[model samples]
Target: MNLLNQTNEKIIPSLFLLLLITGLFSCTSESELTQVDVVVYGGTSSAVIAAVELAQSGKSVVIVSPDIHIGGLSSNGLGFSDTGNKEAIGGLAREFYHRVWQHYNDSLAWNWEQHSDFGNRGQGTVAMDGESRTMWIFEPHVAEQVFEDLIAENKIPVFRDEWLDRETGVEKENGRIVAIETLSGKRYRAKVFIDATYEGDLMAAAGVSYHVGREACDEYGEKWNGVQAGVFHHTHHFQVPIDPYVIPGDPSSGLLPKIADEKPGANCSGDDKIQAYCFRLCMSNHPENRVPFTKPDNYDPNDFELLGRLFDSGWNEWFNKFDLIPNRKTDTNNHGPFSSDNIGMNYDYPEASYERRQEIIQEHANYQKGLLYYVANDERVPEKIREEMKNWGLAKDEFTDNGNWPHQLYIREARRMIGEYVTTEKDILGERLVPEPIGMGSYTMDSHNVQRFVTEEGYVQNEGDLGVHPHAPYQIAYGSIIPKKEECKNLLVPVCVSSSHIAYGSIRMEPVFMILGQSAAVAATIAIDDKSAVQDISYLEMREHLMQKKQVLSLND
Candidate 1:
């Protein structure tokens, strides 16, 4: 190794430096660093799919995930499907559902719910198929099994529970990511990198710009932008006014603990507050294998007064949405004012640290579990409602290892990267054109409440609820996944792609992410072949590959 001498001059003690020393040195040094054709960050459903596709395409690929599990929400408890237009799905995403059908092919898979009773209908779309093409709904283990099968068949490399160096890990030269260093001091080099995390952590760390919250309607020409007051969906609003002060009726007591001290944003503008998050719990009626709801150690009965008020006002019909998956488990979600979704309490979660995020996740779990415990045991919850709550318990066959609690918490919206191409509501609503289409997304632009605060008028109110339909399937641009060529050329982002809060609401689903992941792999392969930037990858070539791979691009006018 040569060192710079005094005065910082290139004191080349050139003793016959004619043997191509630097070239050989680079070859020897870089060889030790692990290299792959593709490196996918975030072990989400999409990241796994991307790795499998690239490996199947005869290219070496590796997936590095922060979480221990493989699948994102799909392998988590989100077994209940969220498909708006089922026909719009194709490619690997369709294959995922098809694999679920194969799992249920064995008669033993029906041990939980009745063959006829196990309904696959979600909203207007049917998640199951008698034709055996796809059975979209499944248990957590079933989903995990399918992902494992894909990994095994493709022989893809996967490193679970590997966190990326959130700062200063991305090594970029000539506008291309040459390699990335994880927190474990291991370096991974790849021709192309795909950010497949919901939080957009890797993308953000690589200097890929990303948006955090919703944009105003005027900013993007969107109809359903900004704070929507008086628009209550699924019974999470405050019909009565409750003061934000410490006391029940006093105004001079100042803001309470849960309510933030900052002023709420203008009604027409956007804010950083994201919608609520929850766990897609799996519960069963089988008492033998059931885990009864236990009071959380940090449970506070006062945290449930708002729910008690909602229950008192004749909203006791709790079983309105106990969507049952296979293996005697139900993918139960929030229903009433105080349920699984800790609305308005998870605003700062998307951008928080892992440890901080865990705190938030546990906070939600405690709140949700407390809600169940309260409804089942508390005297104020009404006898009829209490009885119904008591009968429900965690499914034993599902998440059997850890007190029957869900391993994954539904992080609905986290850190969304402000990428090269922002996918605004205008694109999904068909009001504006999105260039360089990669895949399609067809789901409702749905956002849960972000804040559940008592209004100044002494009534309770939940804010940050917006629901709009993406009337038809719309194309997602390839540019949305990558940074500008000047910023980083070799990175592709699927989960945290550029989208307004409204548009992300529709595109954030796992199936869409999987489809985009396959498309990103195709683009990466093409980029590697041509030695081109991610932005410079020819759409003609990418589009051809996508069409050949059966990944949907556009819908007919």
Candidate 2:
């Protein structure tokens, strides 16, 4: 294997340099030595929780992340917290939110708005719990600070901006990862490994089996696994008929920009297309804290023509879900048919190269920024709607280094590991009891639109917007987090657990990730102690360990 630059040019070193680079293997050099009991990958909210749990379990650990900032969506403008059934959340996940509550208790934390003015509000839940003293909604910085405190308190080593050298970095011996290296030539040798990343990058590099896209309903016996067209139960579908063509009523003219010309697939067939990804914008209307929406440098009016048409069709519900956080900030997520989710454009992101991923991120940023500018200033927008939109802008104090923009994109679904068991709709709906419960996921099986295409009737429609409520909070199986017994015995996956697309939609919440992360760490420590594969660990012992950590394994009657 060779390390290639962006242009695919190889950089070869002299034999002496090669010897020096790999000297730790031959000469056991101390400088190149990095040994730990547990090595966690990704800087997500789950990653931090897992690292803390490992340290608390009396084990040495390190966090290897490609991001400059940690906490993933929790600190990336997802302050509204997409938590369902908070009672199901326990352990480190609840502690993180409690920390957020503690931060806001300080009078200095409320800068833009008075604490009284920002009354308790959350998505179908209580924002503040007096008895628990935990705040579920907060500004982005508060969440980041809480994560930083977790790291500082534990004294866990972290190496940020270290991309995994996927092709040749992971070294394995007899189907077990012995050591892994990063693109910066940093190596980590560990007894056990956990892939806590949303993308499952480390698991993939270690040759673990995983699935990328939706599985067919037939394949998993799931009701909502595959391409779902004509499933317009939400307001996210085009409310009124809108012509997708550039020149209305003329077939010769091309379709409007951003409106795909492809035909959406059969209703229940599997495809390689993933759900849309977007930067959850943190916005505010306060005069002191608001930075007015600025037109992106590559703004294109034609990109959002369909939105103008929606406005003309008497669809003015643009602010339906501008979920408010503390300090006058809003977690602005995709609300309607044409919103922040750059649908269909992120199909290539899950497996794209780092350079290509950056380009895709920039494109999403430009598109969302341009959409805000259009809604605020475009003449085609309804006067009343434009006026309301003009009042909201990016928060001035948040993401100060990135021009008040979110640093992380909401990767709703990605590469899911195909492990010992796959969590399907049956598991989520409580039709089938998952054995060896590790954690619980109660969020609705929510998936954003996957494709926006023209219908046979010549109207634009968005497919794959699904929101099905589960019968109750369901237990996540321990087998779902461990890879196949034959593939990789020492590795555990938390963020990208084995699940079908529809089930993962519910399990993909940040709180659920943290819960699974803590569970993963417990299992990892146990596996190291037993000197056995993660799949071979005793389920009873795992459940007992999780319960000792305050994890809720089974639902109460």
Candidate 3:
């Protein structure tokens, strides 16, 4: 009777042993199985919003999150919001900001500084609006708390740290995903699945089509699609000529660290290179809340030789992008020719194995951490810059679980699903009309530097940094979120949407992801109710529901 305690029993019957093994296997499988109306994968801002929307719509939904902490980059130091057209953001996305505004309204929220001391600085509008009751900029912890509150208020069940079995987790029948199993053996069965991950892992595992890296200009009929070798946008590129070799003008000395040896590809041509990734560090100048930057274990002064040379050349713009957030904190992003963007080091991240991706992430973290340490302590740095850098450090109260470092990397670009409709610059620039509008995006087509390589003239330069403003806030089509019917009928992709690299540059904003997440949930709900494919959902009906939910589908709306 005590089968679990049996070890080399005197005369165990084979028949009894077989029955016991079968029963145990069945019980294990049953316990691991989770059935729901909709399963949202990922733990990003989009994932949280999608699950909340599904719950609000009376669907039995569950969030199978790969992240231990939700809200992705929003809570991971990107609190200086990149919202372009504030009016274009509505639905749960706007609600998230409203909650942020509410939290800051309390005097207790300002722990480090007075509310009036925090100036109203934002991308294009006031950071905090009294009439709209929305606050665009915030501290990282506050954003994370808002996301947690939303999930708790909606009673959404989130299984955190559940990594999907990317190779064979998705169980498909007749091109529809029946279930997805995580690496922990937890199985999620749902009528509809939404891939809210920035990496598009679920969509790819479900055999959905996707494209990585940049597309050629001709492929999508877009002007800013491919290798932008000579195009310099913003202030990320070198303003003056910087030598590529360790010895100035001596090619025999070899290229300096961080400078790619390969020649940058031709302009207007396609390449497999992706934009650089960095940690949007939440830094603080307040002495009580600042954790002074420390040199990384693997810090190599030689790695920053170019940066030292740039300093010698009078390129002192390190603090230009330390955008201010509340609580006397800053959302410090990459700036100048050599700041934090780890260029040419993440090309294999989008499709790499999980272990490999982690390695890449760690490598990036080390590079950034080392850069900060070098600036603060290295004698090569200018005294003015070094003294100023010493004042800022990682926020002591943020990302407590990760040694005050940001938990999420700014995955600027990744595997983009090539769904029914691929958004291109034509759509973003108002040259082409979007069909079946679901949301609107107005951010500039902004792509960070992809590669830092030696020019034909033998000088160091950065390529693929672009910033072209859209004609206006443009509508995003429903087809952009759903896979082709033949590929996967029951799955929707909100984060890694179908779009050309240039168009995704604008649509990739955090607020846009939240907007699409809500829209995707609504579409999935319609598909589940009608017992129809996500691709076949009626656009008119979806539009009506979106309007009711206060989603800004177009500029006219």
TM-score per model over all chains: 0.90, 0.94, 0.95
Query: What is the C-alpha lDDT profile of model 3 across 257-367, one tens digit per residue?
Result: 999888867788999989899999999999999999998999999999999999998887889999999988999998889989999999999999888888899999999
Which is superior by lDDT, 1 or 2? 2
Global local distance difference test of model 2: 0.87
lDDT score of model 3?
0.90
lDDT of 2 by residue, 1-557 (tens): 01122121111335335534744123246435467888899999999999999989988788887777889999999999888988888889989988888888888988887888888878768898878888889888889989989987986767777788888989999989999988777788998999988889999999999998888899988789899999975788996799888888886898887777788778789999998999998999999889999988888898898898888888878998899898888998899999999999998877888778888888888999999999999999988888998999999999999899988989998899999999998999999878999999899999999999988888999999999999889999999999998899899999999999999999999999999999999999999999988888888898888888889876782
Runs of candidate 3 with Cα error greater than 4 angstroms are 1-31
| lDDT tens digits by residue: candidate 1, 1-557 | 01011121111335113212432112135323556778899878999889887977777777877766679888878888887787777788889989888878777788755667665665566667867478878888889889989987876656666677777788888877788877666677888999998888878778877777777779877767676666765455555444555566665876554455544566758877787788888888777767889989988877776566567666665776688777667888776555677766777776776667777777877877887788789998888878877788888777666667776778888877666788888888888888988888888888887766555455556777766787788889887888877778889888888778878888988889899899989988998899888888789988898888888776661
Show the colliding residue pairs in model 2: none
Q: How many residue pairs clash in model 3?
A: 0
List lDDT for all candidates, in order. 0.76, 0.87, 0.90
Q: Count the backbone clashes (under 3 Å) in each candidate.
A: 13, 0, 0
Question: Ranking by TM-score, best first?
Answer: 3, 2, 1
Off by over 4 Å in 1: 1-32, 240-248, 251-263, 555-557
Best by lDDT: 3
